[model samples]
Target: MFINYVKGLLIGSANIIPGVSGGTLALMLGIYHKIVYSSANLIRLKKVKEDTIFLTMLSLGILTSVTILAKIFKSYILDGSTRETYLNMLFIGLTTGIIFKLKQEIKTRNNNNNNSKKITKYFLFLIGFFTTLSLLLLRTYNISLDISEYQNKKSIKYHIVIATSGIIGGCAMILPGISGSLILLSIGTYKEIINIISQLNIIPCTIFGISTIIGTGITILIIEKTINKHFAKFLYLSIGLILGSILQMLFTITKLNVKPTLTLKISSGILFITGIYINRILESTKK
Candidate 1:
């Protein structure tokens, strides 16, 4: 239970980071399946006792982190353009590490039908590649649709918007390399959602939170079962998605033109090496 809470806290915090995914962290920590399966069975309260316990702990951690960290995220970390640049660089390293790790996983797995596996891999690779390319383009296209502003005008309308964002975020949370915060940002609710949480606006938060829980649970449940049944295909697609996102994020980060100071360059180098070291440590720990 304590372990699950720790895992959730790590993943929760990761999810809030602009370019990171809680699901990606969960996968790195070797708890993705457990977390997703538990979420699927969370509300049942009948036969799945262990899943319930783990999910309860995990939920507590995620909720606690969101309520507290969202404020810090909005106020300090992402407050300025300068800071956002440095942060994005850090996330680029994180995403790079994820791609490396996923690639390692794919290499370690042996599929009996090599040709079929290769074809499926190529198909999924294109899907992930094109999806990522489209999102990268959308960032600059900037056709402003501020759904949250509409919600603020009418009390009843707010519920509908929050619910819709929750459903989207919930599903995005499970997708490899896709950031829920980025999805919210693209939708123009990133600031509004954070502000609503920071203000302790209970009704809207509660409604969104519950809806997210339900949607996330169902989405992860289906994903968990499907991945378990088709490990090779899922692994290939996830790896491709991670690879594509890392490429896109690198492009985005480099274009920001935040010239790294000598100190910043040294720090980034340290972080990159540290990321590799951490992966090795995790691998040995599992051994």
Candidate 2:
């Protein structure tokens, strides 16, 4: 139970990072399968006691971590500084290590498969890579909107927009490489959601939260069914997306143009190596 909480905390922190995916972190932590299966079976009450306890602890951990980290990151660390650059580097390394871990899993699964199926996995990986790369490139040019202005308007249209954004963002969260916050950013609601969360604005936050839950539930069900039918293909595609997401994070950091002093460079290197080491440890423990 304590281990589950820790995994959830790590996943929540990863989710709050702009280019990191909670789902990917869950994969790295060896809880992805459990999460997806539990979510899919949540309503059926199968193994209800066990699933409830596990999911409840995990949810609490994620909620706590996200709320705390979001405030800290938004207030200080996201200021396009050397700190931000180093953080991105660390996460990139972490994500890269996850990709390697996933590759080994795929290789083991495919050991007895025919060459044609193996080739298909590689092709799907490339396809997934380019698909995510294209989406991230498109997101770079999204126009910023003044979300604060809509806060005062109690119009139904505004509520609908917020609800829709929440649904989309929730679905994005389940996708391996995509960040839910990035989806909100693309739709110009990222700031608005943050403000609502910070202000403890009950009405809007409730609406958004409900939508997110519904969206996530539906997405998880679909993904669970797909994985059951096509594990290798799905895994390969997920790996590709994870790799592409790391590339996207690096591109974004480069665009920030943070000049690295020697000390900063050395620190960043250490963090990167630490990230990889941590991931390797997690993978080994799962084995």
Candidate 3:
């Protein structure tokens, strides 16, 4: 149980940091498979006693770690535009590193009987999820959240946006190559989410928690089966997903009040490369 708590701390912390992968962190901890299987069966009321205990401890650690980190980030880390720019560049580099990791994995899994059946299944997934995807993109072109609007009780549209963010976050939490925090950043809700958690805003947290659970339950089965039966297609899908998310992250930040100073350019170049290198090393490593 103590170890579970520790695992949760690490994984949950990873979940918040841009470019880090909680699922990959879980994989490194050698707990990914069990967590997945247990989560799946737990929903079915199988091993309720054991799984609940395990998940409860893990969840607590995750919650504790994230809350603490959120507070720290809110208080000290993300203070200035220049600092934010540097951090974002590093994150972008790290996130880009996942593409290399995926490149290798996709090539490795390419030997699997590749065919169009898997493509068709994914087509259906796309069709079924068309509306949800639409909701996510609604803010893609303009990624900032206007809290003032929500305060007026006229932020139903933004409310819907946050709710959709929860769903995407939930699904990303379970997937390996893609992480929930990264997706949230791409969708323009990362900082708002951190602030919300730090401030203990009940409404958004509730919406996020509920949607995360729902998204996990809804997508896990489909995702598991797809990976099992169509490994190559899943890799391709993952690549596309990461690519799109990264593009969005960069795009949204461009809309921010960024000043392209010399220091900014140099830091951006160096840190971005450093992030990619660090990510590549970590992603290639195993326990």
Candidate 4:
């Protein structure tokens, strides 16, 4: 039970990163399905021992990370445009690693079957591409809610709006390929929550946090059920989405500084290559 909670905490922290998802972390940790099942089966707790304990610890970790890191993350988003670009690079590296792993797994599993269809692979790739593209384009809208100003004028209407945004954000978080922060940005609540956190305003932040918990629970329930029903197609789509997200992030902040330094280029290549190498290492360990 303690192990489950601890792991959940770590996963929660990973999910809070702009380009990552709790689901992705859960998948990496090999608990994706189990976590999903646990959440979706919340009502059937009578048959599941210690489910609440696991969930509580996990939730605590997530809460701590979001409150603490939200401000830091927001700083990157708002301050000196370079932050998002750097973040995008890191996520691109991470997603590239995941995509390589996914491809290797698919190949290994299908190697013995000559009758296996190849078109399905391409089909899944396209799904991921389009989904990722949609998120990238969304950045242009500048749509976001600025909730931090509520400290001076806390109203029921503000709470309702924040809660609604949280629900939508929660849905984006559950989907393997979608960026939750980006989704929040689209709905207009991301900036508000960031402001609230940045200013260290507790009341409104707490309200928004509670709403996120409720929203996350409900959203995960539905997504998990759907993934379980269509595992392969969903997996392929997820890979595509992750890949697309990486590309989108790359393009969103694409900039060519005057006279590209050889050092910068070398360092980036190393980071990307190192990321690829890490993927290979993780894969070999799985065997």
Candidate 5:
């Protein structure tokens, strides 16, 4: 239970980062399937006791981490400095470690399959990779969210837009390699929403929260069904997205002109190994 809480914390924190996906972190932590299964089964009331307890703890952890980090990020990391670059480096290491684990899982699962099918799966992997890479690159240029409109009108239209964006962002959150905040950014509501969160605005935030819950519930149901029918292919696609995310991070760092000092490089290397070691420890404990 404590371990699950920590994992939840990491996932929540990852979600706050622009290129990081909470779902991907959950996958890396070996809790993604369980989370999806539990969420999907929530309405059935079967295994109610266990599922409820697990979800409750996980939710608490996520909430705690998000709230704390949101405050910290707003206060310190918003300046777009080397600190943010260093932070991204650490997360990249963590992501790379997870990608390694995911590859091994894919290989083990596909070991029994035929060569042609394996080739096809690899092709699907490439498709997923390119798909995600394109999206990230496009996001760099597009400004979809109209914050001016949001600020000028406090009418039903504003509320509806916020709710709709919340739903979309919530759905994105469940998809591996997709960042919900990025969805909000694409819609141009990311800054406004963050301001609302920072100010603790009640009405708008409440509406957004409700929408997110509804979206997450529906997404969990859909993904659970899909995975039940097509686990390997889905996993391959997920791996591809993960790989794309890693590349995107490297790309962003290069674009930002973050000079990698020797000490920073050494620290990053240690953090990368540590991330792998921690993942292995978590998997072992689960077994």
Candidate 6:
């Protein structure tokens, strides 16, 4: 139980950081499969007391860690434009690591498949890539889900966006190489959701939080079935989503403070390296 709690903290910490994949971390921690299976069963109201306890401990840990870390990260975002730029660079590096790790996994598993299957995989990859890119581009261009100007948080559009963020973030949290926070950033609610936590905005935060839980349950079920039926196909699409988002992340980083002192630049570079090294460490330490 204690171990589960600690694992949850690490996983939650990963999800809050843009470009960090909680699913990958969970996989490294030797609990991804367990958690996914348990979550799906819990959703079905399985009578197993053990799964309930496992999920409860993990959830408690995740909630505790996210509640604390979101405050710290929100401050980082608020500190200065240059600081935010540095964080973005770190995220880019982290994302690059995920890409490499997935590439290795896919390459190793691509054996025993013929040309037609390969073609289908590539097609699915393109679908995931383009779908993700297009959605991200919509947010980047302010065409969707930018409800920052609304004072009343109860507006239908605001709720819709928040609900959507929760659903997306939740599902991403389970997908290897996919960053829940990055998706929220693309949706432009990353900070707002953080603020809700930081400020203890109860109703909306509760809604979002609950949505994430529900989404995770549904996603785990879907992913487990999909993997059983078509494992490589899903990974291909996920890789596409990862690749497409990387381009937008670069663009977003470029939009940040373009002029930084040498010190900030160097710090950003180091953070980038550290991010990559973190993933490398996770990859090497896989369980």
lDDT of 4: 0.64
Candidate 4 lDDT by residue in tens digits, 1-287: 55666666655555555555566655554566766677777755543656666667777776666667777766555343644445555556656777766666666655433334456656877977787677666655554455555554468888788777667777667666677766676566666767776687787777767777677788777767667665655667778887766765565546323234686556566666775675566556656
Scored against the true structure, residue 126 in model 2 reaches a CA lDDT of 95
Once superposed on the true structure, which residue ranges of model 3 sit more than 4 Å away at CA?
1-34, 46-54, 75-80, 112-137, 143-168, 175-196, 201-208, 283-287
- What residue pairs are clashing in model 6? none
Q: Which 10-residue window of candidate 1 scores lowest in summed lDDT?
A: 144-153
Q: Which window of 10 residues has the lowest lDDT sum in candidate 5?
A: 145-154
Model 6, stretches more than 4 Å misplaced? Answer: 1-4, 17-21, 24-31, 45-50, 78-80, 146-150, 153-164, 182-191
Tell me each candidate's TM-score.
0.89, 0.93, 0.68, 0.78, 0.90, 0.81
lDDT of 6 by residue, 1-287 (tens): 89899989988887887656687667556687788788777778885798999989999899998999889877766354776777667766777787777777788987857999999999989987786577566656766455667657879877777788898899888976567887787777888898898888898888899899778878899987987788788778877876775665566566665676798779988988987898688677764
Model 4 TM-score relative to the real fold? 0.78
Q: Give lDDT per model, in order.
A: 0.71, 0.82, 0.69, 0.64, 0.78, 0.78
Q: Which candidate is the best by lDDT?
A: 2
lDDT of 3 by residue, 55-164 (tens): 88998999898889888866765555666667667766766776676677666756645457657546644543343244346555555455445553236776677788
Candidate 3 accuracy as lDDT? 0.69
Q: Tell me how many clashing residue pairs each candidate has.
A: 0, 0, 0, 7, 2, 0
Q: What is the per-residue lDDT of model 1 for residues 1-287, given as tens digits with 9 covering 90 to 100?
A: 68778777877877776557777777777777777666666655544877777777987888888888888888887654446555655556666667777777777885466787689777987786666556666666864456736745347777888888788788778788777776676676667778888788888788778877766877887787777787767776777666666665566556566676897677766665665566556657766
The digit string of per-residue lDDT tens for model 2 on 97-207 reads 988887888878865578888899889899878876776766677655556666554888778878998798788888888777766766678777776776767888789
* Candidate of highest TM-score: 2
Clashing pairs in 2: none
Query: lDDT at 190 for candidate 2?
Result: 78
After superposition, the stretches of candidate 5 with alpha carbons farther than 4 Å from their true spots are none
